[model samples]
Target: MIRGRHQEPAGERESGLADEAEGFLLAHAHRDQARREAEELCAGMPWLTTAQAEELTGHYVRRRLDVTRDLLLTTALRAGQLRQEYEARYAGLRRALLKRHAAGVCAVLVCVGGASALACLLAR
Candidate 1:
């Protein structure tokens, strides 16, 4: 059963142990919270066993994770949509600015032409 156990690197073993410890702590916290919730719900009713409470807690945690994931996905999609809308608006504004600049240049040219014509008539 332990034929290749000695072949594992020391760092790998240490990391595995650390991961296990962390998982145990996290699970304990979840279980404790579950126990509290179950106790409240089970008040004035039949008591639940430790195993039952743990099972119920696991279900609660799974549902919570699913909801959190869905919320994150929705938020990310909305953010992408907002970014696209703003970018489109920025492009539209840039086009409008260029058109205004062109109109201003044309107006300047027309004024210069009128002034030059008046000077020529006066000289004649």
Candidate 2:
């Protein structure tokens, strides 16, 4: 049983290798599928030559990249706008809180002073 247990690691290593091979095969398959789809698309347009098909694919890929770049830029701009709004709100809230705290302190001081004056008069 001890020997069998030691052999388990070897089995696991082989399984790991199999998994890696499967992943490689899957990636290749996906590339082939995309190529096939592109070929079909080119075939549908009988006027396009093989070179033109390749060029079209390149153009599409570039367009996709450009769109993605634009999307990222838009997202960043929106984020910045949101951050500024939040900061403005935070500053306003902070100022309000400070004013409230100051008012509370003044009320406390007045109460203490009034109580002391009453006490002094009563003692006399």
True-vs-predicted CA distance for residue 90, candidate 1, Å: 1.5
C-alpha positional error of residue 48 in candidate 1 after TM-score superposition, expressed in Å: 1.9
Which 10 consecutive residues of model 2 have the lowest summed lDDT?
A: 60-69
Residue-by-residue lDDT tens digits, candidate 1, 8-87: 68899899999999978876676567656655655534576767766766676666556656876899999999999999
Q: Would you list the C-alpha lDDT of every candidate in the order shown?
A: 0.78, 0.81
Clashing pairs in 2: none
TM-score of each: 0.60, 0.61
RMSD of every candidate to native, in Å, equals 11.8, 12.0
Q: Residue by residue across 34-79, what tens digits does model 2's lDDT show? A: 6666667787898998799998766655555566568768999999
lDDT score for residue 15 of model 2: 97
Q: Tally clashing residue pairs in candidate 1.
A: 0
- On the 0 to 100 scale, the lDDT of residue 94 in model 2 is 100
